[model samples]
Target chain A: MTEELIIAGFGGQGVLSMGKILAYSGIMQDQEVSWMPSYGPEMRGGTANVTVIVSDERVSSPVLNEFDSAIILNQQSMDKFEEQVKPGGVLLYDPNGIINPPTRKDINIYTIEGSKLSREMGNTKTFNMIVFGAYLKIKPVVKLENVVLGLKKSLNERYHHLIPLNEDAIKMGQENVVSILEL
Target chain B: MAEVKLMKGNEAFAEAAIRVGADAYFGYPITPQSEVIEYLMTAQPHLTTGMVVLQAESEVAAINMVYGAAGAGKKVLTSSSSPGISLKLEGISYMAGAELPAVILNVVRGGPGLGTIQPSQADYFQAVKGGGHGDYKMLVLAPSSVQEMADFVEDAFDAAFKYRNPVMILSDGVIGQMMEKVIFKEQKDRWTEKELIEINGSWATTGKTPDRERNVITSLDLDSHKMELHNHKLQAKYKQMEEEEVRYEEFMCDDADYIMVAYGSSARIAQKTLNKARAKGIKVGLLRPITLFPYPTKVIHKYTERGVKGFLSVEMSAGQMVEDVRLAVNGKAKVEHFGRNGGIIPSPTEVLDALENQIIK
Candidate 1:
């Protein structure tokens, strides 16, 4: 199966890096993957997005229009990507920044208080990991073990000490995600 | 050394160049391709293999630096984006005229002037038809994926030296910016002084040997007859390349009714569209030109005889390669063009729709 995902948020929210980590995890599982970012000025301080495609077969187009899933971290990302999720697919979002939640009834929608949970953990930088936790819990595309290995490969050795905390954030997300639809 | 790693396309290109033991690299900074120079500078190949990496003042200066190094019998390269590459056209022409062997990487972006920083295949005509003055031809290699981005560096250099002319890696922003798993080549040692003297001694300006006649590397011939002979020599070399160096990939064309012709990033997108069209009970295939200059014209012509009904040339430009497709078809079948220029990448759905509306209709 091919999982085409779009992760979007403000530039500093680690949206691109999150997609990179996911792609690396897919690679670790011997899957063909591609990570393509919406680069240039949009990555400076504005909303940035990356398209990550992980497949059991060769990935054809790294750049895509619609996606099987959309991970929205902010309202702007939600406003743009809500309609892009394929029917009967998945939509995961952070409730903190979203004023109007997704209204798509055909797809499965889930919410995680990732920003608030990460803030409560006294580390706001772990916001994306928290969201990723919820995503894996819902979709479970790549194994959790592979995600940890991906972190080890993607992060510098100096940052390796914080892997446990990031893991904890992911667990917190997995435990806290509220599914809004069964479809 | 034959290791597998997930790397960005630009960084992989830089690493592959180092592994291939390139003697020198001169480049100016530009979006989507700046990572190439950055990675080379950070890796500092000079300390490892004595490979010199210098950031030139401008694209013109960078290409000229490559010309100078290539004249001295060193394997050299330079890279830039569309507008920056435009600035290097004069130097590129001079290198071709003088028969200097060099590799040029164009991580193409949208352009007619200073266009968007996004990906584009708009430079197809400029790259294959000669971007500068003179009736010259440079071997053009179009890489469709990050893996090809790395693999083509060595290929480009080899082709450049084989013909004693410049070669271009005609990549677009998508191949330059995307990240994917790549298997790197094993390291090769740089050429020794003895090897250089043996290989390039005949015409290289490597400080004229004492036992041989003084060699001069130049394209200038004042006499009309001699200049015409030089032109004929270049044309003959180009004809040889066309005969021997044409490279292409055909996917699902055994019983295809329609074919999509594309290169670089557009080719990747076309593959996806081909899959979609096949699922909808349409017999569509993809013909990707790996070498743009020595185009896959003969292969395309072969399809015409095999009952292929129509051809769709998809690009990131406003119908540049479509003309070539039309020529190859030679009135045997219909040929149509579909594209999204000015940095807008056409989606698979749009391409499929175009095939249904333009070609099938």
Candidate 2:
């Protein structure tokens, strides 16, 4: 199976890092993966997105127009990518800054209050992990254990102490994700 | 050491250079390829393998540095984006004329002059057709994946030294910035002083021994007849490389009626388009050229002889490689070009549509 995803948010919101973690997790599962980011001037405090692909077979193109999933963190991303999700695909978004939520009817739309929950927990940086957790809970493309291992690999040795906090955030995300559609 | 790690293509290229026992690297900072010099500077290969990594003031200085180190028979390299590479052309021509061995990488960006920082194959003509002034050629290697990005550094160094000429890794921003799994080869020992003398003593400026005359490294020939002889020698070397080193990969082409010719990232996208076309019952195939300089001309001619109905050259340029494809096919088959320039990468659907509209029709 192949899962092509786009994760977009502000530059400091860890959107690119989340995609990196997902790509690493796919590698941990011995699957083929590619993580491509929108680089250069577009990444400076602007809406940054990364295309992540995980497949059992070789991934053909790192660039894509349609996605199996789009994890959007801001309204600008939602406005931009909502229509690009394929029919029956998943559209997961954090509803904190988004004024106009996804209006697509063909895809499965879900909301995770990642920023709000992370703020409540007094660690706003855990927002991306929470969104990622919700994504795994909804799709379950990769196992949760591999994501933890992926985190260990992605984070530097000094940051290993914070893995549990990120794991807790992910678990919180899994529990609080609200499904808005059946299709 | 057989360690597989997830690495960005630019970083992996730097690590591979260190692991391959490269003697020196001189480069200027440029987007999409800056990580190569950054990683090298941070890793400090000089501390372990005695490799020198210097951030040159400009691309011009960097290429000249490469020329200097390579004149001493050392494995040296420099990398930059399109505009930076343009500045290095004069030095590149000098290196080619002097027959110095060096590896240069152009992690290409969209360009006429200072174009977008996004990926582009627009540098194909500049890379394969000799961007620098004079009748010269550099062995160009196009890598589609991160693994090839790492692997080609060693291959390029080997070929550069083998031919005593410059070699280029013509990658783009997509391949350079993308992250994927890469397996680094076991560390190779740098050439010892004894090995350098034994291997390159004949032509290298390794200090004069009492037994032989001093060696000079130069590209200048004041006499026109002497310059013609030098040109003939370079052309002969290029001919030998063409006969021996043409490398390409064919995907499902045995029974294909239509062939899509692309290299690097364009090739990767074409693979997906080929799948889509096949699903629609179109007999499409992909021919990816691994070596752009020794461009698989014979294989293209073979397809023409096999009665392939048409050929499509998919690239990120206006129509560079298409010219070469048309030249290779020689009007035997209908050859066309499909592209998205200025860093706009063509989507798979667009490529498929181009195939249907331009070739299949």
Candidate 3:
């Protein structure tokens, strides 16, 4: 079975980081994974996204055709990718960033007050972690311990200091989904 | 010679350049070819061996730096992918026009624009026929393996110096990324540069010395007779390189009925295709080119004469190698092509299927 996910938003909204966290978690679980971000000039203000595929075997291409699940952090991304999600796929979006975004009754949609929850958890940028927590609650691709390990592996010297805070944020996301959404 | 070590093609070029004591390396970053710089970054430049490394602002600047370094009587090298290489053409032509000696390593990727980053041999024409303007030829070397990438360093520099011309080591993403064992020869310098450009002293400007004016290295010859003589001299060097530097690898082709020709990463896959054909009891063999500019035309024609019925030229590009195969076959053997472009690498299974269509089916 293929577990494909696309995370999109404005460049600095932590969308790519969330996608990479999921991808690295996939890797930690011994699942085949591929992650590629749009690196062109349009990345600054335009929607930036990462396509991630996790599977049981070697992935043929790093590109995605139809996403099995997706997340959007900004209004533009939500509007752009609203219809791109596969039928019966899962979609998680930040409620604060989107207004009048179309709702699909056929697919599962989660509108989380991600930024608010992140601020409550002591970091405003941890909205991505909240969504990650939501996805993990619904589809546990890997264990919580494995996500930590994956994060550590992907961190470089420059970002090593942020690891503990990031882990706290991920735990907050995982816990917030349970207490708030009853997920 | 040294013991074999598994290496990727880009790293192989890096090792080879260092082995050749290249005075400097100037380049810009692009995929598939990025490993060239990555390797150099990991293996810092050692100045004592005459290595100077710099990451240029752009490919244009990189190649132009090559022009300057080469003019300084220093052996120099640079590398880039398809689009970046295209940007370097103006400087490349300038290098050619001025008859500068340097090695250009291109880890080719699919392209017309900023295409997908995949291995392909589509740049054969641009490289061999001269990517820049005017009637000139650069000695182009197409290496099929990491080993060849390493080995061709001497050949590349030697040929460049021999002809007072620029030489290129053209490889693709497959060759660049694929890891394989290689045997590196004891690093040797074939030509000692008296001065990067002054090595060939027909210069109108060098440095004003007592008894000598200056040595200016350029391609501008206003007088027709002078230009003709210069052209003849360059042509003579080309003829010499054709005789001495043309190289290729042949397999079980002597009594084979069908032939396949390819190079770089595609050639490696073609080898596997030949194996699959042989397993099916088909008398098929491969003619893999190691040198692209001075293409191995004679060797291919040899197979044609020995009752070879058909040939298939496979590549990542649409039909770059097809033209050369047709030239070699010269209507004697039926030729077909199978390929993909824009960074899509052709698979061995696909090539075997094509072989079946033309030869078996």
TM-scores for every candidate against the unseen true structure = 0.99, 0.99, 0.65
Error of 2 at B170 (Å): 0.2
DockQ of each: 0.86, 0.85, 0.04
Q: Between prediction 2 and prediction 3, which has the larger lDDT?
A: 2
What would the DockQ be for model 2? 0.85
TM-score of chain A of each: 0.97, 0.97, 0.87
User: Could you tell me the TM-score of chain B in model 3?
Assistant: 0.92
Candidate 3, CAPRI quality class derived from DockQ: incorrect
Question: Which digits, one per residue and each the tens of the lDDT, describe model 3 over residues B317-337?
Answer: 878878988998899989998
lDDT of each: 0.93, 0.94, 0.76
Residue-level lDDT tens digits of model 2 in B21-132: 9999999999879999999999998999999999998999999999999999898999999999999999999999999999999999998999989999999999999999
Ordered from best to worst lDDT, the candidate numbers read: 2, 1, 3
- lDDT string for model 3 (A70-183, tens) is 777888777777787878887877777578665676677766667888888777777777778777776677788878876776566698788778777766666655321221
Candidate 2 deviant stretches above 4 angstroms = none
TM-score of 2: 0.99
Candidates by TM-score, descending order? 2, 1, 3
Which 10 consecutive positions of candidate 3 chain B have the poorest summed lDDT? B188-197
Q: Provide fnat values for all models in the order shown.
A: 0.82, 0.82, 0.00
Q: Residue B23 in candidate 2 has what lDDT?
A: 92
